[model samples]
Target: FFFVACETHRARAMQDRYVLVLVGVIIITFLTFHQEICKAPFMPHLTDPEPPPLPPMLMQSKRQLLPDMDAEAPPATDVPSPTDPAPQLPPDPPPTGALLPLGPSLLLYKPTTAPMWDPTFVPRWQHLVSIPIMRSRHSMRLLDLCITSILYMTPYPKFDVLIMLDPPSRALIRKSFLEGRLEALNAQYLMVPDPIYVDDFYTGKYWWVDWPMLTQYKKVLYIDNDVLINADLNDMFDAYDMEGGGHIYAAQEGEFWRMWKSTPMFGLTWYKKTDYDRMNAKGIQSFNAGILMFVPDQIFVTNILEMRKWMLKWMEREIPHFTDQSFVNHWFNTRLLSKSILHKIQLFPEHRSYPGKILLHWCASFGTPASVKYDKMSSYLTTFIEPRLPKRYASRDAMVAGLLRPQMVIAEVGCFTGNFSQVLLETQPKELHLIDWFKGQGSGSDADGGTVVKLPGDQALQMLQDRFASSPQVNIHRNNSLHALAALQDRSLDAVYLDGDRGYDWLMQDMLLASAKVKPGGWIMGHDFYTYDRVTNKKAEKSLNPDVEKTVNAFLQASGLKIYAVGLDKQTSFAIRLMHPVFWFK
Candidate 1:
């Protein structure tokens, strides 16, 4: 046993020495070979073992020099140590024939001058979202000096006007915005410190003509707010020549001969007289920048930025009457024409000053004196445009609509002329009782004869009877509402609406009976649930009856029923039975 143990210890020590020698050899070898192993560079994996030698199709003929494919092999430049970053090279060009968009599609607005408006009295119109519709004495041209122009522009649903505001103007317009004068127009706010061209020569007037790059719509339709499209512009979208890499869509300012000058600043008759003559002989017209559909290229954006620079250089020379428009004329007619390219600016001929065209360019209509009546334009808007605008429900109408349910019994008290009752009947309810005596003495003064007091009771009933004759659901009771409800069974009604005479006794009498007649889970409501204060008097231009408000409050307070304002104007108020947990919690 002692001899075996001694042999085992000696063998173990020998094995340990052999392992250490083997490890030392491996360490030395790895140190020598590590650099070469990592020297294999990273390249994007493609199926091909080598990159294709041919240049991209677009680059083949146009580009003067193409990047060498062989140079794509990983360079054996300075070997990066552990702490060193990988060597940087210019990024690989986009894949062959891969077209990248210039930028996102956007709608832009520039409010250079504030509009003249009274925001509060303006009605909330659902058709015109996010557009300020305050009572404006200023012509649309003045209001559209920035953002207001879009109010009468194309009725495109996707038009959420991107109002480009400098930081300082935001605060000044904050109140008008909060008041929701612009809610109908769908206004979006963007803060630009200033325009791209901040030079003195570029007045804020038509600078928004460059809205394409400013709002970042690679392809854009820039219509001045004053210009309204008589037809949908969707058909016109495909009409644009997007296949051509460079294109500009605009109307000719006037005849090229009329705008031509001895210098390049005009229609470039002097700078590129030969090219102008050539295109002119081919029948191309000089164009306007006002209404345009164009792709914003680096070429155009560069031209815009260089306008100030170029003008400064040529200041010892002439400046044209129209600033940005002339610059754009020079860009297409001269710059692109000289390159033997198709000048690509397809001007809309026979359509420029053609009033009967798709676009109704109420040309040069802005900033005119208020006394200068646009009676013809008003007729056009009223007859052609206003009739075409989408009709929307008023807040009061929508409130009445929400409460109505089919297969329910309801009563409308003091339903003179049944104007509001029309909204309720839309639900096709099982039965609706309309109550009004249709007889009240009129003092001839508007204060007493306001609406119901002067209405002929017998004729009003005839109208209601005829209006609802097709609807078997409506039942008219030509009597005072209080006496009318006595005939109705207790807990028989699902809802009761009291919009009767404004006298305290009349309102209270009707409300008390309506509350009792409505089922335990039913709705009880009234219209004009507001005090006749100075605000109301001033708005109505006469004294309003306060009895409607007083009677409603008293009845609801005494009955311990919580009333909810149904419309934004607080003209309608309603309360349901105290059965729902929502009412209890409130």
Candidate 2:
């Protein structure tokens, strides 16, 4: 037994000696290769010397780079170590995207002059998701689909969209669709500086356009134009905010070799063994730049100047096949390592089922030629997306034009100064009756049980008469809405529009009377119907006549009639096709 114990102790000593020898070999090998490893691209000098002074052009630039920040201080060259505590940030500003107080330590890069693209692009939100549009026939087509999808798919609390337009495209889009479609969609625009070319080729320089917007917005979600929105991006936006705003969030590019060139994994190029090893050690992985979410705060704002220097460096070095995507992956490599997985929006080709994906990115890596992409996007929109989107009319006049048919009898109860009467007549209604007390709206009398006091309609009546006097189909009536609706035979008129007094009981009576007069298959439409937040179903605070919605809803319950359609306009319009027999309880 004692002999066996001695043998065991000797074996343990041998095992310890073996470990010591192995450690010595590793240390010697590392010392011999230290210089070569340090020379690798990924072994970035942690203590890099301060960059040279700003170039003449950058110095003389119109935008004063770092507002209220330390002029002597250099931009952050490295990400805060994971063990380091988070830099204390000021309390969150209101969600309205109001500007934070400019403290001496807070570096902000705001434009001194107005935005070159569009002066009207006043950002009122904390987060803005921007899409860049270049001048071309194909691009214009893409813009239509992109904007349409965003406006349609996004619910009530929609994300603010900034359409970054090059100068040439701005003129063409403004002339063609901006006035009618884009404007109605409430999409904003910014005229970006002209196309920037690197080595006589456009290398996606437009991506930088969003960098400046961070000054105005707390966060910016940069989306490529070719990227089609399949579902609401609200979840993605919320996820970004929840993670805190300092990091860049993007999906990993499936193939690492596409972004980095190193030994073993990526075939040998300029990148050395140590470069790849260091990147792996730091947890850095390349990500697709198609969709990126980043905060525009002091950290990023201060680094704007450093980014410019890096651009120059990459250009002069003549890096092999360098592009904006490659630059972005390296520039934000630190944050890339810990990029939130929640930001991995499903990519295309890999996933064809559109039901679950937030965005369907037709990435350039797919090698789809521009012409082919055009056809595919158009076909996809027409087949799957467009059909699902709700039908939207730009104006009340447009809605009326689509609904009314030629030779149909129509009456507008509050046709003040014949604004809508003109619209009704344009439809070539068989007989258009214009009714108004035209004294504008009257005040409700509390003493008379909320009865609206009718006023004289002399001037307005005369003006309406002069405007529609030449039209043979027009008939003007100067009377209260109740009397005007009552005089008509029951179930006789094709359609009647109630736009008079918005008082609760008065509107209820007007709706009841109009319902009885319209034919079973005809319409009873009204103006000033309140708009509601689509998500919350709460009446919008800005709704002028809140009582109109109350009255319309009350009438629907009592009469068993449902609201057929609601018009998207400042003063909301609604229609109710009289589909069933009229039944009034009392």
Candidate 3:
């Protein structure tokens, strides 16, 4: 029994050990799993992928809005390769200016302290620009002053012209520029330190320093009062080698460079050879200070003022040589700056005329204050200058011109004051029959065409008589257009231009008369097709002539007439008549 009891106790102890071993294994497994779960967040799985991109804040557009947009455009124009001038913005335009419409037609600007010329004066440059323009109200006959300035503006009408002034001068400028032409011209006036009295000249060219203001322009030109422009300065501006050291554009002073050295200064003292040679050398050219072209900048301005100061000191201590020109010759010729000349384009000899002469410098050309100086200047007005000026026109110029030919019989039905007859005259028609009543609803009507003078019916007849007096091609009948047109033989005229009496009845009557007179396939063109008032910037509620449009449409509808072209330009309608088979045969 004792042996059996000992064996049972040993078995129980072995069973307890087995239970302990199993419990220890379970605790170790739980601890290891918990540690692995904690570590899983810090180390991500390798198989995971990135999230998607966010939507746009707003809808995107594919439409092109830039010059460089990936679509084709006209190959870009090269920026003007003018003198290596720094880029420039045009001057701020002056405030609302006053127009003097009375005698001379002057426009006055609100003046500012802008400098007259550019800070950099490039000597003998070709491109043109300016400082300012002012009108003079003085003794020199206004016509002389006006024509002289007009010469400067003729070539550069595309740019602003600075006329230095007579109030009456604007009249000539206006006639030269504004009359029957459209040009992008702005007249600028420069105010200088005044009391410049040489032969009572008001332009005061001697006070050129006061011209350029603000120094903001890329290129500036000083066209002498005497110089005539042959072409625009764009070519000249481009001609310069802009890869430059600072320079000003001016003409070589020619004989004056050599002449002034020997001539007495102000007729007082002879310029010694050594003193003259200091500022003059064959290698170093003396440029005319009278006309200059330059870019405006701080350095250019500093040089100009410094040279002027020195010249003034020289002039005050001794008799001045060659007036203000002495300052320029000394400034550049001292090896102080760089300048160049294309020769044929710049200064020409006084006694010799070259075929390639683009600019004429008359500083001493007329020889010691000639009497007919202005008379010679005025002659250019009729010669090369006016012929080259551009003519601007309303739309449909070619269309209007193409309809007629030389020696074709035509009539102008509403030939009020023979305004449009001038254009038709260019075709040199065989016979131009003009029919008009020449009477209007008193004055202030389109009948007088807003001219200062109002013509009565009799006066209108007389005016046409005098205008066509030189040419036997014109025939005039001052009567009721209906009466006159009714009396005419059918199919007598090639065409009729109706610019007469407004209102439905008048327009229809004129059209009917034109229909009777004009041949089949002949055209009828009239003014005021669509109502437009420039000041209103909208279609007119009522046309200048009511039913001008309605009558035209009704005529076309009734007659079965095909309109070749229907156009509106300068507020005038151009329509061509097509032949109907019945009318042509009948």
**Candidate number achieving the greatest TM-score relative to the actual structure:** 2
Ranking by lDDT: 2, 3, 1
Tens-digit lDDT string for candidate 1 (1-586): 3544555566577776665555557667877788655652222211235423322432432212222321333322222222335334333334432211111211111233332222233222212112121222233322332232232333223333434444334554553422132333444543433322222213333333334324244355555433444544433454445422345656655556765663333442243456557556755566655556655566555545444344332221222234455555655554342122223222232223233345554444223432233343444554665454332223455655654556778888867777768877876779989888877532112112234335566777777788989888889997777679978996688778777677887777776676667764466766665423334432242324567667767876776544532443324344333211111110
lDDT of 2 by residue, 208-327 (tens): 444455567666778877777777665557655534334677876644545354422222123334444665776666677668776666666445434444543333323333345555
C-alpha lDDT (0 to 100) for residue 380 of candidate 1: 51
| Strongest candidate by lDDT | 2
Residue runs of model 1 more than 4 Å from their true location after superposition: 1-156, 165-183, 190-218, 233-246, 262-269, 281-283, 311-320, 337-358, 365-379, 389-586
| Residue 72 CA displacement from its true place in model 3, Å | 76
Report how far off residue 169 is in candidate 3 (Å): 8.5
lDDT of 3 by residue, 92-200 (tens): 3345321111111111122233324334433332233543223332212322333333433332232344545433344444544221111222334443422211211
Model 2 segments beyond 4 Å from truth? 1-121, 155-157, 196-213, 242-246, 255-259, 262-275, 281-283, 334-344, 349-352, 366-368, 391-586
Candidate 3's C-alpha runs over 4 A off are 1-128, 131-158, 165-184, 196-214, 242-246, 255-260, 264-282, 338-356, 365-371, 387-586
The whole-model lDDT of each prediction reads 0.47, 0.58, 0.49
